[model samples]
Target: MHIGKAIRLERIFDRNTKRAIIVPMDHGVSVGPIDGIVNMKEAVGKVVEGGANAVVEHKGLVRCGHRAEGKDIGLIVHLSASTSLSPFPNAKCLVASVEDAIRLGADAVSIHVNLGDETERRMLHDMGKVASDAANWGMPLLAMVYARGPKVKSEFDPETVAHCARVGTELGADVVKVPYTGDKASFEHVCDSCCIPVVIAGGPKLDSTEAFLRMVHDSLEAGGAGLSVGRNVFQHENPTRLVQSLNMIVHEDASVAEALAHLNG
Candidate 1:
């Protein structure tokens, strides 16, 4: 890795722990203004106050969320976008470039790719171009890879998720994010298949906080770098508390019970 890339990566991943608690606030592009992130500034503030390492958002919203004061957090500019209203919503398009993210003072850039989607080929082509540009500019790239196509029988299948992880690494992402394989053993295989840091994506919001915490715990046990969770963190009744709980789990290696206690207490 280039020194510049490493330095920028340190902003998002803890230097000592080498892990991250990233809250994605970029969902507004895909799903419209969701509940937690309707007020971008407030949502960003809540996560930063609770010790999130970074927040992922699209280029347009950077100014809305950027803070000159208060606890500092890394900014990751998401380059790809797709609207939920689209007939093929899984087909993501690159709306920003590495140069654009740098101009926005981003610590990193991210792209989303649906591996089995009908538009997967185009997405992969764009990803390759982004990876090349990121490398040239010495910017770290995080790939949010998913298997959400017609042929995908199970998005969380260990083998399928492992392929997703590898696709990111093979395409030159610094960190890869994929859905967890539902257990430590299966998830471990997903982690082991990728050379770069593997982070688990928090899918939909779960019914219980304990289940969420437990999933984080299990993913970490299976050698995940951390989490790129959004809805579960930002939509919670206490967003800060939830992020703090995740921080404990990802950075301090706290037990699920202990992390839950921190959230509740």
Candidate 2:
């Protein structure tokens, strides 16, 4: 591994735990400014105060979330985008470059690839190109891979999730994020098959906080590196407390009960 890549990854993944609690705030490009993230600096501060390892955002919004005084948090510049209003929303296109992330002082860069989409080939090509550029620049790359298309019955299907993870690894991502496959056993298989660190995506907001915490705990127990969740963490009633509870599970190895207790306390 390049020393630069390793050093940058430390910003995103805890050095002691080799895991991460990443909050993706890049949704502004995909779905417009939603709750919790409209004030980028405040949202970033809350999660950072809760000990989140990193926050992902698009290049332009970097200025909005930049902190002048506070505990530092890693910045991951998202390189691909497709708005929800687009006719082919699943088709993610490269909107930024590895060089752009470097210029923005990002610790890492990320791209999204939706397998089984009509523009899967183009996304894959973009990913491949970005991976090469990132490697050349020694910038850590996080691939957000998912199976979302007509043929896919359930995106949560373990097999499909594993395939998405594997694709990320084969394409040279240092870390890969995918939807959790519902249970520890199934998700364990997904993690086992990928050589690179695998993290779980938060997906849609769950009905309850305990349910969300339980999912995080289960994925960690399954050998997942940790989570790159968005809405669940940022949109929670208490974003700071929520991420602190998550930190306990991801870094302190707390059980669901213990983490939930921390959340409530």
Candidate 3:
């Protein structure tokens, strides 16, 4: 690993572990107040206390209050934008620059690119440029890759997810955030191909805790580094305990029940 990449990784992980838990709070840009994100600062505090290594957010969130919100956790500045109302919502554009993130003392940077979309090539082009900038500045890049297009899988098949991860790795991402393919047995292909550290994203808040924990455990069981869940953690009734339980699963390798015991917020 490059000295710079190693230094940036330290900012995002606990000194003793390779696995990490990061909460993404960049929702304000797309879905305003869907759920569990009513208070960004408060939500981040709960997760931080529970031992998340870092939090990924848009520039506005960081500018508004992430510093005081996440003083103890790493901050990854997200520079991409896409909205729910847009007909071509998958076409994300770069709204912020690496220089801006560096000035804000970001530990890393993240961007989202939907592979196979009509505008896929354009998005990848932007990602390449952003990745180059991050490399030149010695900052780590986290790529959120999702396969979406005319032939993309409806629920994200293992193969498609693996392909997405591979694309991110080939494009210079230090870490690739992807969606889980239901189970450890199924998603292992993604981890195996990317080689780069993988983190699963929480797509939407689940209806049950069992479903949530199962997904987290399955990801790690397969070979993932950790999770970048936001709504699932912040929106839970007991944010503190929910996050703590996630920490137990991700960091301590605890079973679902053992982890759940610590989650009665």
Q: Which candidate's lDDT is highest?
A: 2
CA lDDT, every model vs. true structure: 0.94, 0.95, 0.86
Candidate 1 residue pairs in clash (backbone atoms < 3 Å) = none
Where is model 3 more than 4 Å wrong at Cα?
67-71
Model 1: residues with Cα > 4 Å off, grouped in runs: none
For model 3, the run of ten residues with the poorest summed lDDT: 62-71
Please give the ranking of all candidate structures by lDDT, highest first, separated by commas. 2, 1, 3
Residue 62 of model 2: what lDDT?
97
Q: Which candidate do you rate higher for lDDT, 2 or 3?
A: 2
TM per candidate: 0.99, 0.99, 0.95
Model with the higher TM-score, candidate 2 or 3: 2
RMSD of 2: 0.6
lDDT of 2: 0.95
lDDT of 1 by residue, 95-203 (tens): 9999999999999999999998989999999999999999999999999999999899999999999999999999999999999899999999998888899999989
